[model samples]
Target: MGDQSDKGQHPANSPTPYAPYAPYRRPGRRPYSVRMTTGGSGIAHGFPHLDTVRAALAALFRRLSHDTVSTFPTSVLPVDVAFDDTEDVHLGAQRIARAVVHQLHLPDARIVITFREMEHAATVELTAGPEYFVELNDRFRRHRKDIGAALAHEVTHVWLHRLDLSFPGTRDNEILTDTAAAYLGAGWLLLDAYREHGPFSQKLGYLTPEEFGYVLAKRADFFDEDPAPWFTSPQAYDAYTAGRARARQDARRPPLAGAGWAARLRYAKDRRAAQDPRRTAGPVAGPGDGYAFEPAAGTGAPLRVSFPCPTCWQRIRVPVRGHLQARCGLCKTLLDCDT
Candidate 1:
């Protein structure tokens, strides 16, 4: 009787799968929701089309060919392209590097591109691979064109860095990189690509589709053509439509006064003076002074003070100065003084 048998007894306590274990609470002030949602500190919207992108690059290439001065060193860089076996993002970065290498004519610098499956989602990082190495994002694999464009853009940054052209804190440095790309004959393509995938959003400090268009437009103006037609994308279309409308409106609006009006009046006066010598000679001293004035001509006698309306043929007085508003006696239509 010292110990009771409990082999057949059911245990009073049990654990349920659905039992709440205080929910997985995040530590340290919830780590800020906005910070968590914003994936990276880069802009991430508005991408452009492929053809426009190519055209822009081709244009840049052509320009670089024509430039007498060279911003890049005489020696060229070597570039190696490869994809990450484990991650899909590496494909895009690899493709972009290849495109850049293909387009560039460097001869001395060695560049190795490798794809690595890293913890980060997708990014392009520059490193010293004995020469230079870049790690590309996996997402780029699906968007080949964007990859090429983005890689070209970053490569440009590298070029600037090597040249000691980059300045800290000033937007001018970024602009210089962009300008250098264009000047060397790839600006339009880069701009097109930028428009296609460039960052945009007031809240995010990214370039908007419109801003991309505007930049492309400026680039086009620099080259003297409509960049819109070169590359066709939703962003390009919207920009072109808006730009065309603005141009038309601008054309219709009267120019500022002064020189424009003076020119117009001068032309008008010259034509009138050529047609009537007497009018230009001098005003008559008096209506009937000794000056032998020609008879009131044109209709044999002076035009009748009142005459038949041309439309209804009713007698009507064409007012002196021909500046009075009147109604047709027969047609009852309002008539302008000049008419």
Candidate 2:
């Protein structure tokens, strides 16, 4: 086949041009299908077993961002590529979905993109079969800036469905999914889609643009990547800056590295209590089970704080400034210390 310049104008029923780019697949494997429903609170109420989820996502994104570096597009997509026809929208969505799935190493799975004139922005049909179907609200055809983020969010549903992961209930699964999309890399596109000017604005995704920015900023911080230049929307850039500030504020809390399971349980409780309104007293600074604060010397020295590692119960101390690296002397466990 010859190289086609306008890939989007290809025949409607033909296979996506991206099919040849699939990088991962096992021979003689039959595709399995799983059905999942779409309807729940988009608000983030946190998720159960969050620590484990975060740990898994951290490892997955570390590999995906490094190995599948080209999964994301190289150039910034125009935020105003409007479409008047649903077929054109579907074609564009297909191209974006192909790029995302190929990057995630899912060479065998095929996703069918369709559209419906609906109130909700978009949804993915999680069926108990191999074929994946994503339906976008036809309204989005006019709001082209959201195409990438919406497709990324739905495509993430397919990936998570294939992994057979689910939260305890429906109330927070959407938030978890949103977090996965952002933390896993697609969330950057969502943040970049955020647009607001006076009365006209468009924000698309399971989570609010601010929440998306928060997760993206957190991931960028983890990967040591600068996300400022990637942002096209001024509103998104502002949200990202604010989210980074929040992450830094939360970083002031003590390290939960060396505590035992029981102690870690108590630490979670204490951490929540510290945020309770009735608890007006600040975090007690002492050399006890909880975090301890060390007074600075003279006038210019920075105050240092210490916390027990969740792994080996060793107290690690560092200046109360920005995030720093720490190594437990007893267990020799390396840690990323923010407190």
Best by lDDT: 2
Q: What digit string (tens of lDDT, one per residue) describes model 2 on residues 176-221?
A: 5667667666667776666666656666655555566666666665
User: Residue 94 lDDT in model 1?
Assistant: 39
Q: What is the per-residue lDDT of model 1 for residues 1-339, given as tens digits with 9 covering 90 to 100?
A: 111221122224521111111112223321101000123334333433322332333333333442422333221111223233353333334344545544443323444333333342222233322243443333333434444444555565565554444434434344444444443434344434433344431111123334444444433433444555544355446654553443232112111111235443443343344335356343222111111122234434432123223222233454223235566544443544321
Q: TM-score of the candidate numbered 2?
A: 0.58
lDDT computed for candidate 2: 0.55
TM per candidate: 0.38, 0.58
> CA lDDT of each candidate?
0.36, 0.55
Which portions of model 1 miss their true places by more than 4 Å?
A: 1-98, 101-105, 108-110, 115-130, 170-172, 187-207, 224-232, 240-339
lDDT of 1 at 339: 16
C-alpha RMSD for every candidate: 25.5, 11.4
lDDT of 1: 0.36
